[model samples]
Target: MKIARREAWTGRVLLLVLMAATLMPFLSLLVTALHPSGSYPLGLEWPDDPQWGNFATAFTAARMTELLKSSVLIVLGVVPISLVVATMAGFAIGHLRIPGRRFVFLAFALGLTLPFEGIITPLYYLVRDMGVLNTRWAIILPLIGLFMPFSVFWMRAHFVNMPEELSESARIDGAGTWQLFWRVHVPLAAPATSSLAILLFLWTWNQFLLAIVLVDDPLQRTMSGALGAFQGQWGTDIPLLCAGSLLILTPTLTVFLIFQRRFVTALLQGSLKG
Candidate 1:
């Protein structure tokens, strides 16, 4: 009993420490953002007179409305297509056991190690040759491809662990390949797919390196990507910069908070099955 109590206390303490570590930076940013523009505030000091209008100023100056639209469009373009392709590939490899599936899975596994920075230079030239540089397609297309390996791996993990009895029963129902996947498996995979969609949405929305490198126009870049331009113009104004940074970060935070339950559920489901 004493040992169990000690372990419980240890876990609680660790969780509290981790929670503080995660939230401290955000707290500091909020505190710093409330300071008067062009006035340097050290650390997490609360201002005597907080400048709440800084957020509005940052929003107007950064043209956040347009950035929001661009981000939405880019996410819409990337996430759905990625989910579809990754799910299909995973189904084939995990459920169907298509010919040469081992080799195909190996290829995707190798692709998982290919770092984004390593491919950027070659990607630049390829996009330039294709004449899609400086456009949304440049960001959209590459992100879909870049995301595939991990996405497919995630889905494959879920599908491979699913009971073979389910597939056998579906086949006994005279269901063809498409019907079996669509009717039987897809519904059961909702938690997995929804969680995957949330992650893809976050990744696509926050894609900065690709957005900055491929798209020159600040207006065309993802919200995080536009941080480069926003910082360039206002780097010296610490408070405004922090405000803009928070503005850019809000959507992602909101998304994660709203769907965190589903995400946690999916993760637990996978772990339990595994």
Candidate 2:
């Protein structure tokens, strides 16, 4: 009993330390953001007078309203279409066992190994040659393609691991492929689909490299991509930068918080029976 209690206490202490370590940077940023906008503050020290208006100042100056709108449009464009394509492709590969699926899945596996930095240069020229540079489509189209591998991989994992009995039973009820997918499989896939949407949403919102490389206008780039330009203009202002950083971080965090339950449920859905 004493040993178990001691181990429990030790684990709690370790987790507490890890939590503090993780939160320390955000704490510092929050403190710095509250400090006077013009002054450079460092460390975790609190300001003598907190400038609460730094957020507002950052919002207006960085044109975050427009940035956020652009981000929403980009996310909408990328995530839904990506989800539909990924879900269909994943179903075909995982459930239908389409011919050449293994080969195609292998290709996506290769895609996972290729990072944005590795492909961004050629992609930039490709976009330029297509004459869509500085346009929203520059960000939108590439992101859909870029997000495909992981999204399809994620959905495929769920579908592949799903009980074949469920599909068989659905077919026993005279369900066609479309009916099985829409009425039976899809309902079962809700958790995974929502989780995929959340991931794609976060990825699309945080897309930086392609946005910076392909699109010229800040209003056309993801929030994270536009942060570079924002930094260039206001990098000297630590408080404003912190505030802007928080603003950029807000949507993704909010989304994760809201869907975190569904995300965890999706991840664990096929892992156990009860």
Top of the candidates by TM-score:
1
Residue runs of model 2 more than 4 Å from their true location after superposition: 270-274
lDDT of 1 by residue, 1-274 (tens): 9999999999999999999999999998899999999999998889999999999999999999999999999999999999999999999999899999999999999999999999999999999999999999999999999999999998998899888898899899899999999998899889999999999999999899999999999999899999999999999999999999999999999999999999999999999988
Q: Estimate each model's TM-score.
A: 0.98, 0.95
Clashing residue pairs in candidate 2 (N, C-alpha, C atoms within 3 angstroms): none
lDDT of each: 0.94, 0.89
Candidate 1 has which clashing residue pairs, if any?
A: none
Evaluate model 1: give its lDDT: 0.94
lDDT (10s digit) by residue, model 2, range 1-274: 9999999999999999999998888888899999987787767889898888999999999999999889989888998999999998889899888899999999988889889999998999888898889999998888889889998888888788778898899899899998988887788888889999998888888898888888878888999999999999999998999999998998888989888998888777756622
lDDT of 2 at 71: 92
